[model samples]
Target: MEKEHLIDKYVQGTISEDERLVLEKLKLEDPDIQKEIDLLSDLKIVTELEDKTDLKNLLKETEAKLKQGETKVIPLFKKAKFWIAAASIVIVVAIGITSLLNPFSPSLDELYAENFEPYKNVVNPSVRSDEDIDAEKQAFITYENGNYSEALTQFKALYEGTSKSYFLLYQANCFMALSNTKQAIPLLEKHSTEDTPLAIRSKWYLSLAYLKEGNKEKARELLTEVISEGGFKTTAATRLLQKLD
Candidate 1:
């Protein structure tokens, strides 16, 4: 504010040292003010470097050009309604965009931003639907409130939507939570090292699900493959082998 005041004072030829200090502070703090100050400083330097006689000649030439220019004045009646219509359209658009941006007012972005942390583990990453987004929100809501069954239902719906490996793997995790090993097998089997990140993950989870189901032979086979495949999923395979032995 003081920076703006200083600009006014400077423009009106009434600036003082104290006001100049305020302008400097404003220039340092606000990007827009800083740019204006840089431009003003450049003008001051150029004005000091140039000869007064040359500047006066340039001003006279500019004034002569201005005098030679056509002097047509636009009548306000010709475009009065056009301006009124344009202003009305601008006002309507501003209100509409503002409403869209603040549908929940200062909370939607902050709330979603808080919830949308990519670092957080997604229980059903494969689900990609508006309904699924809402269902998962409710599932997470229930999970937070310790309602495991409701969370599981929403999570199951998510698995159904995207037979994507992550969804399948998440479904297996949910099944393990519900203590239903029977449901985990097919889900895990669907994701067996087909080059997708989920393929690697599916292999790891499938081995664990097999072991959890007491089929040590199948678990051993998958665990061995994961270790031999030698890539991003190998560490998980190695860890599982260590635990089984």
Candidate 2:
């Protein structure tokens, strides 16, 4: 196959494995082939972006105007100049959009950091009396004090002993605070399925857990649910969804 055709197929992501091997070999042999591939990849992005912007319509209008005077003799050189100028404009627009999309966009980790706070100790209000601080109160105190490891141990024991569903949520929050989304997600998922008052809040934290784990699709799914449920993190979920988009 011609190198040009291979490069085009590569940028379109329609190249077969054999063709990919050929292109890889060509890239190694001639660095200019890789540059051409990069340029074409950028053009493909620009083409898609044009659909969302007015650029596609502008180009079509220009073409229509150029084709209108079919009876009049138009110079080929003039048409070439017009197309060259249009191509330059398209390239410039592509670069601008790429820059805006790439550099300024917050990463998933950043979004997670910005959006996630361990669901506050609403389940267990802190007791100032210090006299009647039981295991449950102690667990919440540890969590509120940011001692996640001890809180996790306490919450796990409470959940195992009483099977109170809120303890599960607190345990998940502890895991999240410790940066252990792997452990947090399953607990949050299980808690979110219950009919308790904290179920919706569990979904919110689950979304954040997924976000922390770099699972945007699951995070988006939970965020959408939080928004549609119409309370408890709806506004925050909406804001997070906008950032993800």
Q: Give the number of the best model, judged by lDDT.
A: 2
How many pairs of residues collide in model 2? Answer: 0
Q: Per-model C-alpha lDDT, please?
A: 0.54, 0.78
lDDT of 2 by residue, 61-112 (tens): 4456447632222222435443464466467766745654678688988888
Deviation in angstroms for 100 in model 1? 68
- Segments in model 2 whose C-alpha atoms lie over 4 Å from true places: 1-100
The best candidate in terms of TM-score: 2
In terms of lDDT, model 1 sits at 0.54
Question: 65, model 1: CA deviation in Å?
Answer: 99
119-195, model 1: which lDDT tens digit per residue? 12454333345464566566555554545566667667776785444555555556655656568678778756354
Colliding pairs, model 2:
none
